[model samples]
Target chain A: MRKFINEPSKVAQETLEGFLAIYGDQFAQVPGTLAVAKRVLDDKVAIVSGGGSGHEPVWLEYIGPGFADAVCQGDIFAAPAPQSIVRAAKAVERGRGILFVYGNYSGDRLNFDLAAEELQAEGHEVLTVRVADDVAAAPPDRANDRRGIAGGFFVSKIAGAASEAGLDLKSVQELATLAADRTRSMGVASAGGTIPGTDEPTFVLPDGKMEIGMGMHGEAGVRRADMATADETVDHMIRLIVGDRSLSPDEKACVLVNGLGATTRAELLIIARRTAWVLDQAGIRIHDLQVGDFATSQEMHGFSISVFGLTPELQKLYDAPGRTSFFSGANRH
Target chain B: MRKFINEPSKVAQETLEGFLAIYGDQFAQVPGTLAVAKRVLDDKVAIVSGGGSGHEPVWLEYIGPGFADAVCQGDIFAAPAPQSIVRAAKAVERGRGILFVYGNYSGDRLNFDLAAEELQAEGHEVLTVRVADDVAAAPPDRANDRRGIAGGFFVSKIAGAASEAGLDLKSVQELATLAADRTRSMGVASAGGTIPGTDEPTFVLPDGKMEIGMGMHGEAGVRRADMATADETVDHMIRLIVGDRSLSPDEKACVLVNGLGATTRAELLIIARRTAWVLDQAGIRIHDLQVGDFATSQEMHGFSISVFGLTPELQKLYDAPGRTSFFSGANRH
Candidate 1:
């Protein structure tokens, strides 16, 4: 891959500078960190989220307006630092409180925890929501052992909606936790991503076979198997999601067919349509379905399926109005 | 390649159905086709543009509010029917008249011409602007033969800005034409896409080489060569765009480091930072810069850089804010 980076190490920092130039309006720079947050939330509970830097609009894209009060950005596939997390929380804290939501990575957990303590010390209430919705990352017994992937969207939407509903800090935290509990994601990778200027694949798969249940950073898949037809692949993912959720025949759900890094809209719709049919055949009702690159892997050639069991209450939050850079919709009101 | 589509033909229709279901309040269907427009502009010069289905948020995404009065959607990479185009134009046209801006393609040109005729017969005045900014698709003598790729952003932004300025029909049309003329694009492709249910790639490329200047549909590239580094690729493209436009060190331009399909944000910025630097070295100050899958070829692993020799006046229009489904920026006005 021919890349224009100064060095692989500087890629994330330089990119943050550019994003800050455009999105700096909604975010204030955190001292000594590559984090940004909303300019105002006086007395309002603040929601903070972060992950690797490769997913363009996922973490950072979901910030602003009714979403995260602030976001901490780290290098590609690397967690943000403790100082960064604390600064992000402080940057968006309006004194109502602060809550941190992040993928279930050890580094992210440690840093966010450290940040939580710092916020609490400052006389502000602070809570944390760890989103570990990836089913393939670990067994059900250790669901939280899985890494957070595209389910970040569900977490983001629900959290933003809860905050916008004028819920207090505890209520907001509970709402986010509830949504995270019900959501699950599974991903597959056709190819691995390359570090800028590097020629080696981050992970490898045999030609004509896909790494099912692949991680966003091209982590090893649960299995390497022959490339299945579209229906077969989708059916496998849908079955796992449906089986795990144990959706009743009349259950309602919201679906997201996410492109990791390089999947196309054409392919996304393919997943969306088939996934919808799978649900329809199972007599599951879909209130809303979105197909796009909501979460990506810097153009990795694979995708993930994310599902959230929804009720009239959760569905309303899922449909809540949002003003993200990529996705938008009406408020639950 | 797991997809959500049913019949190949139904992908566009069904996805649009979902779009309306999710965004019904912000948009209304165009009577019969997969096209839609904002409801308020029944009398403004309806600006309708579209090409294929997969590149969501492009034609339809740039629609709404201050951008396109309405948009027409074609079946993935297929130009919409004349009937659909006519209906879309009629629905969005205010007394100000209507103008259609789209890529320079035989299917698009044929259908848009027929739609213009259809509208004219009904006593609706209409005009068309053909975007031919792609530098890699055609030879210089056949400049009009070049295709429109990511440069569509430049075209759409200018049109919306002009219309929002309340320029008369002819003046707006001319401004759009000028904007289209001032832009050029060069793209690279890393992978190919599969239509839903199909096993074959829409197009194919050697694993170690890149299809330079490929169209957004996996069409043939201007050339296929060894994968160059990102800096080299950006440099190669800059040379072509500057040479074609005779841009000098003192010229001002806007840059779009557009993902062809599935390239990640991390990758886009990796290249975009270099793109910005390259332009800076040329003594060209970017009036604006955006990087993402503004135009794509499904999940292809490539991106394109579009340079628009924007004048201060044109840049103003480009910067105007409007809200669309896929993308929205506030107009500086």
Candidate 2:
């Protein structure tokens, strides 16, 4: 493999070890576990999330004052074990309660759900919010079954802000779910990411072909067709997401254009530019905008576009001040 | 090329257009020029920097309240024209003088000097601080003749903090020079980055080979050898940089492991983990640490290591709070 790794099998643990060594001022590993949490815990509803490794700065980097309180980690691209989640949840809880948030995927659902049950059995009040916002994964009628992707970062931000604002556990959970409900995302993949410790990519695509609606782990996209221009790709993504949610001309949204690992910031901005133009053409207002590698699939060459339709409540939460190791924004609104 | 782009020639302008569209809240384009600046320029020494494109979030992302006041953008891997630099400096200048900061490159030196001459002729005081920290590019006796790469980021941060603290142009320039003097960096490349508008990579390394000390724009490295483990690569890089600087065991420094573009966080952390261990073994103290794609080459599969020795003055500037659109840090010290 052409990756800068020691042992492919130890990529996850070693990454966490190296991360803590450099940024230990901000975080600490849950004792004897592959989980990480903020160095200092606060007395509020604790927000926790986790999944497999490889998506750097996602679950781990979000742990800080206004974001996730703790994160469980698994092997590469695999969900954390339920016990790991239970330990992380237990470690970060204050008297307020514990709130669990994560992307909607089969492995994650099973593990986080099991951990929630375990936490409740241990006498801690726990709530769970699963983000299912990839519009291409399911129709509106089956939105709950859709897989979550980059848009979930905004949901986590909303949860962090609400929890930091001293909302009750139930209120925070409600806000997180609302944020996820208002969000929809779709992506196109120009190339696949390589699995660690191997000389192979997760999947292969013939040259000049783009996979529309690919998942974070190189799962099947909507279709394989000739590669399109950045504007054309954004056009298709916007069409699917807007149509799936039946968004109206009167609606306002916070738009995010996320790079899937290897996409340059220049390309993301191009896509974001097109997204704004297209959204304006459709009479949709952009409440806020962000473009970067908020979410990624290793070094996959692609981008995902997400829009979170903003109600006044969701808009306020979205605009609230927030900070993390990887992302931050002011409450300009 | 596999990159998501429209016309290759328009990549630079389109990227900037997209960036302004998304982040226009914090910055605006200088009219009729490929330059960007913070919407509000404070009455401090105006700091400006820019070079080629493709290195996302470099000169452009560093523009904000506590950072650079303006940046002149160039096309892909090319330096900005003198006219563009003059426009940016003139547009962002307050009553205070303007300071030019950028990597040490012949093209940039020629252009920025011309701009400085123009600014001086226009009755504006101008100072320049060119960073030359690439240890591999020159012997110790000729360190000033070496090229600058990722280490210049820390110098910019130091300059920004000093300028924000109300330092005059000469003082800010001195601190920037100090930062550049204390910093050293080197890199390794596993694969070459593809240039826009063509199917060709900037350079190619055969599959089982790795190049050590490659520059950001794919400049030739010190040597190419069989791929080694992450530990071994870090070992080689640390030996070269530490020995070249004649760093003593008693010196304390900030370490930065920067991704060229396509390297994953997992790999960066692994290298960082080893970097800390290796530095400790050499009895050098790590005062602060950062690992990310601070400077990149459009998704190239490589990383660079930069170390900045911390004097009492340098450490304070390093810990000073600064804010930019893409990065920020607290004054923990």
Candidate 3:
């Protein structure tokens, strides 16, 4: 297909250069590793996160003062290598500590853990928070076996904000843990996204049918039912999420309705509207709402809804001000 | 044909409802109007803008503390009515003045002007800035008639920062003017975007073909050409943009490679990466870079690149800090 570049291989590198020029002011990058806080070597309780490229404002935008100190970007959806993770840790090597946050995928876990070990040997503080919020990645009883989705946004935001606000390394880790404990997310897809320079999708969807519980990276969801309206879709998703979480009717919550690459803001807003209506009718007070393409799936035509159960302290931190490419007002009411 | 909504009609309203609960805390209903903004009107100058719903994070994410004080969301790719624009202005009116900034479309202009006239009758100081940054809307001979694309982000940010930093309504208007003058954007579309709930696209593109200079609303580009590699496409678009603006080899500037809608971040990043390589080879001293779906055209698989030549003052404002739903660290470098 017609595209915008001279060579496919050169695309990623050039884009990174432009990305640096654009967001470089926001993060400090070490050649092989991730980008850390510009002056943030001061406090150790660090939070590092990453993923493959192509999910803009995801791994990178989520990196900043209030969230991840650094984020390692791999080639499109490819896991970053061990050296990159080690470099991310080295950049944020404050005496306090460092926490690596990411999905529970085999590639990410192995590399991040290896980076941690390498850093520990070098006498740098290190930790890792594996995000497994995607219920579709595993069976109901095997929730921990699930993969990560947009829920990474909430987890990373809380963790980064805590770290930037001067929480000690362990304390920051605990903050992400606490936040992650209260967070859950799931998605539905109408189509799959193709990797750049490749014609095949990660998977496939049937014509006139939709896939619910699809992972951000093309993992199959729990069901493939007949499609429905925006309201009906929201109802289906909310029912599943509420049933899983058993949320109280009166609890205040932060809600996120994200576009999975190909969904439009208009479509997303419609979904969010229906979600709020369905949610408000259930008496759940939505204290915050974020609707956009936060964590995309290449060009998949789908969306995911994530909820962050909040405590007062976590809420305060969620509302704190910070800088990043994607969000600075995560959960700010 | 699988999609994610119940009815097409109720989409925008629902989306705004969900948005209001979270990122929209800065906004409130304008009493019988569909527009929204912050409470207590912090600054005297209120910047208002909005149009079709599909271009998320544009008009919506732009309305906040440091950006436009109010936004008027419209139907999918349709302009907000006079009623909505009126609502937007009323909500945005903070006393210093109110300014309306939208694209050069007839619908947006007519409605905004009508709202301004009506608001003026009710005794409010209002100003207007119409964006015509798309070089293809009209020939360079009649650039004023060109359409506005995703470049609205740069214009809005610069103008909003100016207004928030206490520029008079006229000064803020001028800031937007200057930025728009220096900005030129062109795009390439791989596939077409489908209207939600509709099985067909507003337009169509043959597979393996590309349309150069397509509008944000899926309007046919100036020409459909064979798809090329990222660098080739970049060269084509840049030649047009550079020719239109007549930038000198030594001229410095910022660049944006934006997805029309369904263009993957990985794809866009690759595009951005390659574009940077080309400019670097030409010895172009790029000042900044923005890559993503800044202004989208639903799920259309395409991208647009915008270059904004900066003056010192414009650069400073471009680098200033602001917090909002879609962006942060949207400040000067």
Candidate 4:
């Protein structure tokens, strides 16, 4: 695989090393651990999230003031070790409790759960919110089992804003869960990404074909079909996301067209245009729209559309400005 | 080539349409042209930068409150017509005059010249600064003839910040030219990008080889060599940029490692790490660091390193926060 890396075995450490080199002022490594915690500590509920290494600027870059407090990362496509999570949680805790937010996946969930227990054992209050927003992974009856994708951004934003607003731990947890529940997302992959040091792609699709519903880690998509126009693909994905969320005509929602990886901003903007048109035609009001590679799968050429139905309360939090290495918002200077 | 587009022919218009759909609140299209101008006008020298399409968020997304005043885009890899530039300038002019900043390419230079003439004929003041910072394209004696790569971002930033600081037209023009002269960049391309609607790539490289100094639009590079590790390639690139600029020890510079397209953020952060080390070893203080796909050749797998030697004055402007759709700085919010 053509990638810029020194050694495959050290991708995680090296990546973090690089991040720390430039953004050292904003993020610091949790002592002796593979976790990054924000430099500043405050008496507010701490929001921490992470999963793997390949998705740069996500879990780790998302840590700072007005964003997540800390992030625990694993090797490429692997969940963070539980110890890493515990260290990250402890590093950022200021007696305000901790909220662990992450995409819903078996490995991440299990490790984070163990880490939460570790925190609780230390007398630290901890809450977990698993974002299961990918509709293609499960039916509505099995929504909780669906894998999370880009919609986790919404969950993190709500949690961070609520905590920043001085909400108590329990209140922040409730808002995070509400935001997670109101979110839905679906993705289409035109190509799979190669794991570092591996020549083979995470998965493959036949030439001229695209897979809808592929997970961030290249999990099996719902189906494969001939590659269609961007508009058509977005139409299909948005239908799934909107139908699963089932909002009324006047309801407003935040729309995010996230590039998985390797997708051009030009193309994402096109997808964003189509998504807005489709939503407008459906009589749905758009609360806000963010179109970019908020989450990715290490240079995989694909994108996901995420919609978060917003209540007046959630909308306020969603609109709150955030300052992360990877994300900047409207209120940003 | 895998891409998300409707018709290849409509890629430019469609992409801009998409940008306007969500960011219309910030940018408004120049009537009858493929140009976008900031909606918020002020009694400051207007800074405008743009070129071909495909480079999402670059010359276009850079337009906002404290960034660029307007952007004019052409078809993929081609310069916008003079009429478009003229229209963009007219839309954003607020009596302080206009500053045109862009990469030093023949097509862009010619089109912008024509537009400047048009503006001058209309009794509007206009200044032009062509960024030619790619050290690999020419020797120091012919630096003015060298092609500009990602360093154009620095030129635009300095110009925009100067304009926002309420500098007079002539002073803003001088600062922009100074910023351009202080900048140096070099790029390596692993794979070429496909132009819209074309099955063939703009250029091709052997699977195990890379081209150093390759232009953003696939211009011939200095040499072809076997693929090297990220650190090795960056070492080669930084050496040229530093030597060409002849930076003294104890100097300060802003380091920017920009991905062309298809390069992972993981790789870029790693590159940023190495770049910082190299600069530190040279005893040069880094005033700021930015790493990402600031300017891209759509879906091209490559990256460029740009350094802008900063005087105390330039440092202040560099530190000044600017807000754009894709980039936000400390001054934001």
How many clashes in each structure? 34, 0, 33, 4
lDDT of 2 by residue, B163-195 (tens): 999999999999999999889999999998888
Best by TM-score: 4
Tens digits of lDDT, candidate 1, B1-333: 334345777778766665664456678888888888886653456788887777665676667666787788888778899999988887778778898989898999999999899889989989889989888777889898988887888888888878888888898899899988889888887667666557677787766687877777778877888877667887888888888886666557878888766566766766776777787787887767777677766556778888888777886787777655555563111
Poorest 10 consecutive residues of model 4 chain A by lDDT? A324-333
Cα lDDT of model 4 by residue, B1-333, tens digit? 478899988888888889888888778889888889888788899888889888876777878766789999998888999999998999999899999999888999999999999999999999999999889898889877898788888888889999999999999999989999899999998888778667687789888889999888898899999989989988888888887877877567888889998888888888888898988887888887888888999888889999999888988897787876666773211
Q: Say which candidate scores most in DockQ.
A: 2
Question: Model 1 — TM-score against the truth?
Answer: 0.82
Q: Chain A TM-scores, one per candidate? A: 0.94, 0.96, 0.94, 0.97
Comparing 2 and 3 by lDDT, which wins?
A: 2
| Tens-digit lDDT string for candidate 3 (B111-216) | 8889889999999888888878887667988887899987777788788889878888888888989988888888778887877668897678887888888888
TM-scores for all candidates? 0.82, 0.96, 0.88, 0.97
What TM-score results for chain B when candidate 2 is compared with the true chain B?
0.97
**DockQ (Cα-based) per candidate?**
0.33, 0.66, 0.54, 0.59
Off by over 4 Å in 2: A248-250, A330-333, B248-250, B330-333
**lDDT of every predicted structure (CA atoms):** 0.76, 0.86, 0.76, 0.86
Model 2 residue pairs with clashes = none
lDDT, candidate 2, A11-67, per-residue tens: 889999897877787788998778998867778899998987888766667676677
